[model samples]
Each structure stands twice: as C-alpha cells, then as structure tokens.
Target chain A: MSGSRLSRRTFQRLAAGTALAAPFVRGAHAAGKISIGFWDHWVPGANKATTDLCNEWAAKEKVEVQIDYITSQGNKNRLTIAAEAQARAGHDIMAMPSWEPHDKAKLMEPLDDLMEPLIKANGAVNPTVEYLGKADGHWLVVPATAGSQIKGPCSRIDLLKEHAGVDIQALYPAGSPPKADAWTMDAYLKAAQACHKAGFPFGVGVGGTPDSVDTAGAIFSAFGAVLVDAKGNITVKSDTVRQALDYYKQLMAVLPPDVPAWDDASNNKWLISGKGAAIMNPPSAWAVAKRDAPKIAEQLWTHGAPIGPKGRFAPFVPYFWGVWNFGRNKSAAKSLLLHLSQASAAEKMVAASGGYDLPAFEKLTLFKTWVEEGPPKGTLYHYPNPYNHQVLSMAGAPAPPKIAVQIYTQAIMTKMAVRHFQGEAMEKTLAWAASELEGFMRT
Target chain B: MADIAVSRAGTVNGAGGRTSLHRLMQRKSTVAFLMALPLITVIVLLVVYPAIYSLHLATLNKSMERFVGFGNFTFLFGRETFWLVVKQSCIFAITAVVFKALIGFVVAHFVHNIPSKGQRKWRGMLLVPWVIPPAMSTLAWLWLFDPSYSAFNWILALFGIDPVPWTGDAYWARFSVILVNIWIGAPFFMIMYLAALKSVPEQLYEAAAIDGATWWQRIWYVTLPMMRNIIAITTLFSLIVTFANFDIVRVLTAGGPLDHTHVFATWAFRVGIEGGDIPLGASVSLFMVPILAVAAWFILRDITKRGNEA
Candidate 1:
C-alpha cells in the first residue's frame, strides 16, 4: 500500500495538469470567443495590467479572449473604428477615446444595462464622461479605467517660485486643502509673461491636436464661452467667447512663438528638454522627466489649473470601452467590460499605469500609487482632481454631442484664438466661427 | 491545298460544323480580352467602384440616410474654410511640384556630369530622403522645428539670427510644409530625371556642342527637347500625387495655425473621419477630381501626340 502511494514527482505532475486544465474545465460551461481592440497605453506596464485582467475574466467566463492593443498615434484608432463601422465587422470590444463614443454612437451597442449596476456600486461617473459616453438615452460606452488623462498644469516648482514668486505647493498642497482661489487667469497670464521674459515660457500648444484642443476647451469653459449650445445653436458671436479669445490671444503672445504648430508630443518634449517652465499635460510627461531628467522631476508639481471668470476648469480626456453593435459575442464582451471595471481591477490598472490611468468612478481614485510613488512623494496626489478646486471637462463640452464633437475635433476654439492673434478682427473671427458652427449644425 | 482541306475537315468535325463559340475562341480580340480580364476586374473592384460609391456618398445627408442632392457642395461653397482649403491646396501642390521639378532637373544634370562610376553612389545617397517613409522623415522635421528646443533655433542663436517660426506663423507654416514636401518629393523627381537624362542620346549634345552652342543653349535646345515627354509626364504624375498628399501635411502642420496650412486631403479627413460627417468629407474630396483630370488630359494628350509623330 505504501509503495502504491503516489510519489512526489507524480503528485507534481498531477498539480501541473490541473493548472493547465482549469481554463478548459471552466470553458465547459460557456464555449465561446471574443476579440477586443484596446487602445495601446502610453505608460509602461499598463498594457500588461489590462491583458491580465482580460485573461482572468476570460478564464472565469469560460470564453477565449483575444486582445489587440491598438495605438492612437496618427488617428489610427479612429480610422480602425471607421473602417469597422463601414464594413460592419471588427473586434467585439473596442476602446474609444474622448469624442469617439459620440462620433460612433450609432454603431455602438447601448451599454445602459451594463453601466447602471456599475453606477450603483461605484458611484456616478464624472459628468464629462457622461457628456461624451452617453448619447440620447443610451450609454454608448463603458467609461474605461485606462488612458483617462487630465490635462493640468505640471509646473516647475523651482522656476515658478523663482520667477513668478508663487509657491504652487502652498497654493495646492498635496495633502492639504487647496488655497488656490487667487490663481486666476490674470495671474496665469502674468506668470506666462514673466516666465517667457525669464527665458522659460509655458509650453501650451494651440495646434489641432487633442492636447491643444483640450486646453483651449478648458479655457473657454472657464470663461463660460459656449460656441455652440446644447440645442445645436451657434453661440460664437457672444461676449464671453470674445473675452476667451482675447485672453487666449494675449496668453499666446507670452508662450512659445511656435505654439500654433505644436502636436501632442511638442509640450512633452518641451518639458523633458527643460525648455518650458510649465506645460498643461497629464503626468506622462512628468513620468518621462523622472526617467530621463531626474533633477527636473524633483522640481515638478502637478496641480490645479488657473481660475477663469466662470471657474477653474481642467482638460480631461477620458477613455471608454464600447462594444460594436455588429459584434458576434455581445454578451461575452459586456462581461469582460464589467470584470475590468471592478474596483479591485481598476486599482491594479491604475497602479500598473504608474498613476496614469484615472478611473471614471469616484471610489477608485484612492489608489495608493498616486500618493506613494513620486520624486516628491505626492506629486500626482492632486492629479485626480481630489481637491475639487477645478471642474474637469473635455473639448467642446456642454453642447450637443453631435455639434460639440465637430467643434472639438475641428479645433474651432483654437483657430478662433489663432485668427484673433494674427490680427483678424474679433467681429470677423466671431462671424467665421458662427458660420462654421452653423455648418456643423446643419450637417 | 491538302493541308487546308484537312484543317477545314478537322474544324467541321470539332463542333459538327464551325460553331460561333469555336470561331470566337480563335479570334485575336477574344484572346486579348481574356488575357486582360483579371486586370479589368481589379480596376473595377478597387478603383471604379470606390470612386462611384464616394460620389454617391457625397450626395447624401450627414447621417447617410437621406438623399440631399448637392447640399454638401453648396454648403461647402458657403463656408470660408472650404475656400481657404481650395486655395491652399492649389498653392501647396503647384509650388511643391514646380520646385521639385527644378531641383530635380539641376541635380540630375549634376549627377550626369559626374563620372559614371561614382554616379551610383551619389544617386543612392540622394535617393535616401525619398526612400525613407514620409511619416518617419516628418518626425525628424517636427523635432527640428520645435518652438522651444529646436535644433534650428540653437544653430540660429549661434549665429546672431532670431529663430525662424518654421511652422508657427501662418505664412511660415505654409513655407515649412512646402519645404518638407519639396525635400521628400524632389528625390523622386531626381530619380526620374536621371533615368530620362540617361536615355537622351549623347550624339545630339555633341552635335550641339560642335555647332558652337553654349552650355545653356545646348540644354535649352537639346536636353529640353529630348526630355520634354518625360518632364511633362513626371510633372503631371507628381501634381496628382502632391494634390492628394495627406501624410506630410497631416504630420507637420495638421492644417493648423488657424487652418492656414490645410490642403484638400487633410481637410477632407478632418471633416469626414474626425468630424463624423462622412458625406461632407466625400464631397470635399470629390472636388479634387476635376483639377487632376484637366492636368492629366493635357499632359497625356501631348505624350500620345508626340508618340504618334515618332
């Protein structure tokens, strides 16, 4: 009987076989497959987090899952979405960036059923997320936990202290209440001028890229400038819009002379190269600085945006996970999305992204990676809008999704400022914007 | 006579008479059509269908559900950006093509003058810009034109010159986009001109030289006359490609600085793909056909006429 007992090597073999068979055993319950197209993460280790989450969900759901991390570089993701919609085929699940959900709302499966339970469990999503993710009465997408970046001021603490004599830490301390009420647009202009004169201007872009558009949107939102309202009416020829344009024109004067041609990476490069004292971007730039330029990293602080006439508003670009209505495995796709949206999984994703990912849910913002990991120990603490000092918004918000999407993607606000800066009469610029909006509305 | 009789008997027995199908199979035109069937199918499927579909799309409303009947075109005519785009596309294509031709011609002459042995090396090196992908090369240009940390600015500072706003100001952005296009495209022209220059008979040049023709006169009379077909054909081809160019403008300026640098293709992309108005975008792109067709007709007609004369 003792001799017949299993040997140690045999027991080890048995354990290995069981481990390999676990997924197949689960597959016996539901035999199916699903493919997902995810946006390639800019931060290192973020993709692995998503892959692991998806694999785990697949095993538990007994479905084979294939994930493709597609890059957003050069608008390839948008092209893929467009092509899939046109052909009525592609991955069952896809990651849609800000404005994309609204752009492809017709082709997306309504996610209201999946999102309602999530809202109850995790609290309501940010209003900006709702503005872009929901169209009519249906939730067009599930707000994703990856690549949701907030464009806030990542200023050089040392330079701002030296040149502008403003201690950003005192104004928006990492662990303390924000005393940043005095940080108004007027102060921002002054700081920009001072920085430029001191030979380190702010690296704010006005180009057609999303980075530039988002910043311009925040500034416009702060001024309560609604180029197009929710009813699809052209509101460009207004006093608030004029004020926003005038302010942007003046602000552009003090920034880099070539700000108008900058793409999304320009400001990142500008900051990493130590040429700009501040840039409105996500922590990705700071993360790069930490690796490539440690000295600059230590002096960097991510804080709230400056206040405007309306209020303080920061540019927020959120990611959404939407399933195509033409997808074959709609049930499996929704299940995977729900699995990834769990609070535990969201935290892991945020941590893996080095605090780059911001969960749409309020509860997941308390991930430890935001506080514990940094050169300044808490540099990204306020990155998630913890202090409530700034209203997070995206480009062309507060308008009808159809019209706002056009205004945002076409970069009407940035162009308005550029036209004004180049000596176009305010009235002419307003008329031009009004006519463009009118065209959009008609379309 | 006996062989003809035997062939006639074989043809009759083949289909119990000479059937129309058997007769057509032996025809030259039928054989040629059969040979061209694959190519014709590809052309229809890939090119003709897409173009017809695009035109059809242009007549639809935004949601692509209703027939609008030239509404998009009329709407575009009313917009200021559309006019700017049309003007900019023309200037961008014309200026870029003209410069590419001139630069290519000069460089080809220079290469021709070189010892034949070393010409290969120079040609190889000069063709490097054309060989590299436009998107990748544009990245290098973007870095060089960075406003804050531009290598050009560093070089300028070293000399006592202010940094040029390579892509910042509206005019400068136009110049920068045109410059990058020329840099990338001139090499293609150079290669074509080089091939054309090689084909020009050396005897004509020697005769012009013997007849007391100066360098400039010889080129004007001999080289120009000989390479006229190649030059016109290349120019037309380059014009079409340049007019429809999207990658360079999309990468460099993205039609920015108040839409001062937008060309038709980029604008169409912005309006169609990004703006979510596919019908409007299709209409904007359809505007390119008329201009390209005119250019192609004139140049190609000349080539056919000259070919018939030869």
Candidate 2:
C-alpha cells in the first residue's frame, strides 16, 4: 500500500520520464496509419479491387490503411471535401473529381516526386489529366485508376441499326481505330430525329450536373464555340457560338421534351429502361443493365463521340488521388498512391469495373478488360481512346480555372440551349449568357 | 416609555438592517442570473456565434483571404440568375405555405367531423407524409415524376391524357416543387389546427346554431376568431421552413430547366459549395436573415400581445 501510494516527487519524476519517451513510443509505431476518402465505384467489383490493392500495399509496408468510399450522389463527395477543408482535418488521401484538384490545390500535398517515376515508367499521362492534376508546375494529385470515366456515346447496336440505319460496328469497330470522323454534327441531328420518330429518343440532360455539362461542352467544342475562352474572354456573341446554338436548337427539337430536368442518373435510367437509343455516358449504364436487363445489355456498344464541326471531343471525368497537406502520414500516403498508380493495379481496377474505369496513362488505355468484356465481347474496346481520334476534354477546360469553374458549375451552356429551345430569341440568350459570364469574371 | 423604546431600537438596527436588506436583494438577483446561465450559454454558442461568423464569412472574397466588403453581394445583384432565384424563392414559399394552410384546414375539418373512435386512424394515415424523412419521400416523388416511366403518366395514359411533363417544363417544375412542399408540410398544420378546433368550446357552436348562423358563417365567426393565434403561429413556422427548404427542390429539379425552379437554399448551395465560392454562398445565405427576422418579429409581437391580453 505504501509503495502504491507514491510520493509527489516520485509521481512527478515518472510523468517526466513518460513525457520524454512519448516521441520514441510514437516512432516505434511509425509504420503509420492513413485514411483515404475514396470515390464510391458504380461498377460491381471495382471497390473490392481498390480495397484489395490498398490492403496488399499496407501488408507490405506494415502501415494501417483506412478507406472510406464516398458517393458522388447529391454532391456528397464535394461536401465531404469542403467540410474537411473547413475543419482542417479529415482523410489523409481523397479521390478528387475532375475540377477539385485544381480547386483545392492549396489544401493538397504536392505529389510530383511520387508521380514523376510513375509517369516515366508508364509513359506520359493523358494531356487532360495533366491539365487538371498539375497547376503552377506542381502535381496536386496523382491520377487515380478507378472511376475515371470517359462520357462518350453508348449506343444500342440494334436500335441504331434498325431506327437510325447507322452501323455501330462499322462506325467504331472493336480492336480497330474508330472510323467515325464522318459521323458529323449533321449526321447526329438526322440520326436523333430518325430515332425519335421511331420512338426511341437519345437520352441527354441539360440539368446542372456533370453529365449535362460534359455533353453540352463536347457539343459546343465540336462547333468551336467557346463561351468563355481560355484567356477568360467572353465569346458568347461570336458566329461559331451562334452556329452551335442553332445546331443545338435543331437537336433539341428531336430530343425528349423532358431533357432539361434529367440528372446523371436520368440518362442511365433512360438507357437501362430501353427507352433511349443512346446516351452520352460511360459504360456504367450498360454495366447496370447487364445486371438488371441482360437482353438490353447484350445489344449495347460503347463507341467514339460523334464528330462536331471543329473536331471530336469526349467529356472525360477523371478521379485524382490527392494527399492532404495536414495529413500525419505523408510518406505512407504518397507510397500507397504510387502503388495504386502502377499498371498492374490499373489493370485489376479496369477488369473489376468491367472496363468502366479508364486509366489516365497513355499506355494503360488498352487494358484487356476493354477487349474481353461483355455478352457480345469487345463492345467496350473502343471506349478508351488509344488513338487520337477524339480529344479528351471537359466542360470548364480551355478557360481559366476560376472562370471556367463558374461557367461549368452554373450550367451555362446547358441553360443557353434550354432557353433557346424554349423559344427565347437567340440574340437575347447570347446577351444573357454574356452578362452572366461578365458577372462571373467580375467575382 | 414607547418613545424611549423606539429610539433605542432605531439606534441599534439602522445601519445593520439596511445592509442586510440590500445584500438579500443582490443575492436574489445573482441566483436568478446563475440559473439562466446555461440557456444564455447555449444561445450565444449555437445561434448568435454562428450567425456572426456567417456574417463575417459573407464579406470575404471567394478564397476567404482578402476583405472585399459587399463584393459578393454586389456580384450577386448583377447576376440575372440571382434575380430569377429571388423571384422563384418568393413564389415557391408563398404558394406552398398558402396551399398548405388551406389544405390543412379542410383536411382537419373533415377529420373533426368523423366519429371520435375513427379519428385517430385517419389522423395517423394523413400524417404518413410528415412522419417519413424528407429525403426518402423525395426519392419516391422523383421516381413518380420520371419522364419516361412515371407512375402518374402511366395512369394518365390509361385516361388518354398525354404524358404531362411533371418536372420538365419550367412552370411545371415550379409547380411540382411547390406541390411536394405542400404535401410534406400540410400534416403539421392539420394536427395543429385539429388541436385548436378541439380546444374551442362546443357551447359557442351551439350558440351560433341558436342564432341561425350558416356553417360557413359559424366557421368564420367562431372557429376562425378562436384559432387566429394558432393559425398565425403555424403559418409563420411554415413560412420560415418553406423559405429555407433545400431537400425537395435539390432532389426534384436541382434548379434545373435552366435553374427555373431554384429557391434560396438550393441556389446558395450551388453557388457557395458546388461553385467553390464559399464567401458568395455565405452572402447568398445571409440574404435570408432580414426576411426571417421580420417574420420572427411579427410572430413574437403577436405572442406578446396575446400574453398581455390573457
């Protein structure tokens, strides 16, 4: 009892010793722990692949890894990022969507040293990835292997052939360069009209979501219609802009009247319900149909984006792996990110996603998963653009990040189309857009 | 002898009695303040602090670094969408609240007319919409409003009515959002009104009947006059909630059909959070304060007047 009831001096000495040894205690367990905020994958087994990869790396490095797969539904991922930024603490790494890496550059740890070796081994990253992941000569994020999808047209082969009289296989054959340069904006309009008349409309949205913005951006880019140019100039009143608007007006006439209210899920639902002949999206819709409606899934073919007047451009939404600057395990986070970016891991992710995942690296684009997936094998072979047939772009690109983010988030291009379709004068619509852009620039 | 006693007592007790009395008053005041400290702390921490912080946030630029007084507000004023959002918010809140009041009154009267034993069942059934979480119910509404496979359209098709765009056209989208708000909010109003109706003395209605007053007249004279306070309080509560509504509009239209159906909360979210302009978003949210304060002031004044009368 006397020994247990230590003197105050002895107690103080013991406390001092513990305090002195605390750093070493922490160092002993410095195998470290990391928490990652991952994007919730839509593909069936894609999340497992990511988890298994992380687990493999963790075992090898003797680090503890925590993964939280956050959903993009209702903009929850963005909300999580904002909440973490405001609180100055959260997951050590996060899977940032297309515009976020640039948006949160200051809060992120630079991954240049980790990415440089990966890039050298894997060839150059896609230019779109570089445009987003790098800002001010620093790599803000390492391009992620999962959930990086290219929102191109996924056409029902039977519906396209029977209604629109277009041969999907010939236009964009599997394991070959897409012969789709002749599939112009004019052809797209005619085909949409044909399909709509045949009671199968093209599923596209003009809502304030990524799916709508991406489609509208690709369409506008095809006509070389830059509302806000790269230099942050307002070009809404230009001739090309007028041409794009006019073309969109015609296309809108042939589309469903309810296109203005659709979200990212709407197009997927439209296609899976077998009411839409094609949708501008990645293969997730078809992947869902593969489970829910196998008959519809068998007929779906993922292919090249239709050519516009300017060129072919597909909307690519890439997820980037970013480490928080405030993270405790910076070394572990970077190392894990590098491990995930490897070609072996990328292939596993692509297979797990049923080719829904697109790797940003130039050499990793031709993963065998694309060649082997499906009821009709090789349906998604051309989804990944190994050749330079279509330019990989996004809604807010080519404009300065700040202004472009405004334009993209405001859903300006889609709104303009809706206004014109709803019987607004073209000149007035342009004026309204110009004024909105001016306001955004001012802010 | 009495004068001598009084003079002796006055000399003994004058300073000490006065000091004791003063200390007693001070002690009572201190006890009351200490008793209210928890509530004061809660208000200062939860409500007042956040309100002030949001005001501070509103004055900063997009990056939250530079102090740009009124810059965000000025930018919002210049925006055409901002004006549209203002108009839409006003229309949404006013239309939804009015309809909810009318519908709730009618439904409550219907429920009150039923037998007492059956009333509980009907009340429970009517309150199903209110009891369900808004997000879950909104998802059901979203599915029912789908352009292609809407259940409503399926029923309409059987009647040879062309599929009406429930959430597609701008006007219809506005109508849909308001309709959902009314549906979700009317039950609360109904229950409150029902309670007020029960509280009304049956003798008044009998007295009205004796005067040969019609059903409508009795409601207007006896029922309405008696329930005015409850009506005012419920309407004010619904107004505040409906104005700041986000889930219904966010899930249903997402300010779509060219942002035609956007309300204040959804637009603020789109601007501040999604658009990556926290300061501007904060400024947009702060716009709700004046309207809310005015409504609160009117309600509080009404309650105080009622209290004085009682």
Candidate 3:
C-alpha cells in the first residue's frame, strides 16, 4: 500500500475508536464520581468485598463512585502494575499493599488534611500509619486494615510437652503466653534438635522462598539483624548476619530434613497433620488447623518469637495503605480509607477474611479471637516484638522485597550450606556467600 | 535503423498496456487487503509492537532510565547465579527432551502393538498426566514432596532408607523438576510420534519381517528415519518450552532451598520482575533468545536435511 493511503486509514480508525470511547468517558465524568482502578486482591474479601461495600456506602452518600476494578494475577504483580499506573495518569484511588509504599510514593498524593480529621474523630488509629503515609508532613495514604502482631508459636504443644519432655510454662514464666521471644537462639535450636532427636520434625524456614524468608526474618530480627535498615541502606554485612548464619547452621540439623526443599506453605500442611512439631509461624495457620486438624488448632497459640540474647526483635508486616495520588476519586478513596480505618469496619473485614486482617490499632478493636483463629497465620509463629521492632522499628521498611535478603543469604552467602547438604563443597559455601552478599549489596 | 526504432516503440506500447492491466489487478487486490485490515491491525498493535517493545526493554538498563547496549548481558555475566542458570537450562532442556522422546517412543510402540480397538483406552489412560493442569497436578507432586508426609519417602522408607528431599538439595530439586516435566510432556511427544509411526507404511514392516530382518534393525532403519522429522520438531518445541519454563519451577521450589534450583526463567523473574529491576530482568530474559535460537536453528537444519534426502 502507498504510504499516504495507509496513513489515511490509520487516522480513520483512530478517529473511530476515540469516538466510541468518548461517550462512556463523558457519561462517567457527568456522574461526579471518580473512576478508580484497582485489583480485587488487595483489600478484605480480597478487595472485591470492600469495593462492593464501598459502592453500597456510595449509594447512601451524595456522590457516587465509579469503580474500575482489575483482578490481579497475584499481589506483587498487582502492586507493580498499580505502581506503574500511579506513576502515570491511570488510577486515582488505589487500594494497595504498603509493602513497597516508599518505592511507589512518586505517584501518590499526600493526605495530611484527610487523615488528621479521621484520626482525631476515631481514637486508636495506628500512629505509624501517619509516619509511613506521610511525605513532607502530608499524607499520601491513610491507614487500612493490616496484619496484626497477635501471632504465636503454632508449635505442636502436645508433641513438645509429651515427646521433647519440655515444659512450655517453665520456658517463659514471664510473658502472658509462654513467650517464644524470650527463648534464646541456642535454646530454640536445642528444642528443635531435641524434638528431632525424639522423632519430631522441626520447622524453620531455610528455604529462600517467601515463607523461608519470613521465618528467617522473624528469627533474625530477634537476633537484632536488619537486612536493610529503615533508611533504605544495605546493612547485612555485620555480626548480626554472622550470628544468624551460625545459628541457622546449628538449627538446620533439627529442621525437618525436607525443610531445605520446603516451599513457603509446606510446613502448614505438615504441622497441622502432626508431621512437624514446632513451626516458627503465625496464627494464620490455625484456619487450616481448625478445619483439617481441629484438635491441633485448639492447641495452637500465638506468642512473640524468641528474643535473641542480643535483642528483642520481631518481623512485623504492616499492610499499610497508600492512596494513589493518581486515582480518579480522591474524596471517595479517602472516604473508603476512613471507613475501613474505623474500628468497626476493620473488625468486620477481619472476621470476613477468616481473621486474616489484624487490627492496625490496638486501642480500638478487640482482636483476641482473630489472633487465635485464622488459616495460614495460626500454624505459624509470631513474635510480639514484630510490633516493636519490625513494625515499630520498620525492619521491613527497606525499599525492596525481602527476596534480596534471601538471595544474599542462601544463594551466595550460604552456598556452602546448600552444597554441603547436597554433598558438595561446604567450606566454599561460606566464602561464596560472603562474596555473593558483597556483589548483591553492591547493586 | 528507422524500421528498428518504429518496432521498438511498438513493443514498448504493448508492454505498457499489459502493465496497466496488472495495475488494475493491483487495484482489485486492495479489497483483499481491506478484508484482512483488522487482522493486520491487531497483529501489529498487540503482537509485533509488544515484541518490539520488549526488545526495546531488553536493551535498556535496570531503571529503564538509560540505554545501555547489551549492558544487561554484561551484568548477567557478572552474576554467579546466571552461570548456574545457564548450566541448569542446558541440563533441563537436554534431559527433559531426551526423556520425553524415549518415554514417548516406548509408549507409542506399546500402544501401536495393542489391538487397534484397545489402543483408544490405552491412549486415553496415557494422556492423564498431560491432560491434567500442571498447576493442579503439581499440587499432588507438591504433596508427595512433603518433608514428613512424602509418599516418595514413604516408599523409600519401606525399602529401609531415609526420605529424600525430592525438591530439596540442588541435584534432587533439579531431578524432581525434570521428572515432572517429563511426566507432563511425554504424552504430547507420544501422540506426535504415534502419528508419525502410523504414517510409516505397513508394507515396509512386512518387507523387513519377510526377510527375517531383526526388530532392532527394522526400528533403526525404518521407524527412526521415518519419525526423524516429527521427533526433531517435537524435541525442539519441548526444548523451547522447558528452557523457558516458569510455572513448574515457580510452583515447586520457586528457585529455592537456595538459588540452587533457579532456572533461567525464575532467575530472570527474580532479577527483573520481583526485584523491580526491569532492566536487569530484561537482560536475563533476553539471554534466553540466543539459546532458543540455536536449538531452533539446529532443528530447522535437521528438518531441511530430511526434506532434501526425501
């Protein structure tokens, strides 16, 4: 075809597609509602429930909300896509995970005025929400419902007391629940080894998957080891990592022999079925426990992870909220965040998700039941200090996913550990891990 | 000279008249182009443009901020895990391809030997692994690899031994992933080979048999050569797929216990997608092209040679 003919045809089609889209765009605009886009998995009822409830709430209000919802392939993918859009003119009110909020903050509007009124009206709003959401003293996001710190050692209490001949109460005579936090790294290893020696499988995440990283992070924070400090600096080259690695080596022996190969969710199935004796996990594991192994579920408890002799640390994940500065409906998004931030809304959402939502604020809502009952959280361990150190200190405040830590630790730094177990070079693994971490940290 | 000039002018006029006729046909051909207009638009818009866009992405550095000519490739070279991944890709592709071909052939032979009536049932049963969704079926493998509840370990334990971390330990993890690939892919090869096998004339087998040709000789000369094209095509297709596999590895170990289990696809995902380093990820995925291209080149060469021989 001649260039002129092709160019004329391209112009004609562009005109047609635009003409068709124009009416709907105008119609949505006339309604005084912002066209917000988001994935369904980020909120309670996996964001769909929240959107539906928000729509219902919108009907009662003076203004309407035109929700543009997209189902995410997964949470990480959802956030990355949202972050891209947030950078562009794509979304207005994005209900997103706060996992990488700082990275995506380029596209978010500050919400200081919006937040102050809500927080003042409703007490027990997490102050940290303001700290994280603020940039230059203005809010980019308000507090959304988050994963609470009410986690515990979803250990095989029956197995531990009976087989290991260990007394749970005697171990931590101080904390409300026999605190796993107070237990020394040495003690934790010994208990796992004892459990293993007596024919019980131990659950510690050495595998470099998400679950393994969390497992390691929970323990590492307890040891006062930070992967990257709160300021987004690489800080994994100190005695903190050294001590954690040394502990990890001793503990690997007692871990379920298959723990190295264990995928993120592997231990939950094993633990509830009585395959693993003690999982350093959260109460989320209880939901499965309640259904599949009700007897085990009842015995499962949330405790602070063992405090390292060096420090009291917990790996807390605050599923903080950040409103898309680019989202269509600023008023509606803020309204939704405000409603969700309410003690009542947060409580209801948490219950609906089978206790997956932990109240961000301790003062406002009652969370004892949610902590004790959940799917993945219940079978795992939660350290109390995850709130103090991980959330309060922001142990996960680094800009990247904890995968960096896993790669640095297991892939390079711990190559020997992997090789030795596989009957390869044990000594070389240590040397390699140092060099790998050095290289990984360089970028 | 005057007569020659006059005749040449006449010839030029005649040729110009025909050129005008062909131009008229070209005008008619515009309608055919119009008919295919939407298809062409969609392909250019969605497929070709994206492929180009990804190529553009592949050349840039991690932030997508700066253009670095093959900087990603150079950076990938510096990565220790990248080399491991290169090794694993070759091992996985070559191993999975061989196993699929061998297993597929044996099954095809067995199915061919069966009465034609029973072949349908045998084929259906053999297709179970391939038919089941990799994710859904792998859930069971995921179960069998359970540390304590491992069915494989249970079986191994019955033989008076300890459980093996089928998805753990570098070698074991690599082995488990390949075994699963073989399970999922063998049936596809089998069906293709079966078609190739059936296409081979019955007369040749009878001819070989009447002469008292050994079964081995008959297979080596007739069946292998006859199926060579199909086999090459199937293996190449499987090689491309196995080399770029993300799901099986993602679902199984997610490149874990350590980075020990990482393949090129997962490692690329780690550096690029998950790590939020698009430039780095682009580099990793781009490295796969040459490897795939080489394999494709070999297969195409083999197919061409077979075509020439035939």
Considering every candidate listed, which one attains the maximal TM-score?
Answer: 1
* Highest lDDT against the true fold, candidate: 1
Question: In candidate 1, what are the lDDT values of residues A182-293, reduced to their tens digit?
Answer: 8999998999999999999999998888899999999999999998777776778889998999999899999887788888888988898888899999999999999999
Reference-based TM-score of each model: 0.91, 0.90, 0.80
* DockQ by candidate, in order: 0.66, 0.57, 0.32
Question: What local lDDT does model 1 show for residue A335?
Answer: 86
Give lDDT: candidate 3, residue A70. Answer: 58
lDDT of each: 0.89, 0.88, 0.64
| Between candidates 1 and 3, the lDDT winner | 1
**Model 3: DockQ vs. true structure:** 0.32
Note the residue pairs that clash in candidate 1. Answer: none
Two-chain DockQ for model 2: 0.57
Tens digit of per-residue lDDT, candidate 2, span B183-243: 9999999999999999999999999999999999999999998998999999999999999
Please list all clashing residue pairs in model 2, or write none if there are none.
none
For model 1 the local lDDT of residue A234 reads 75
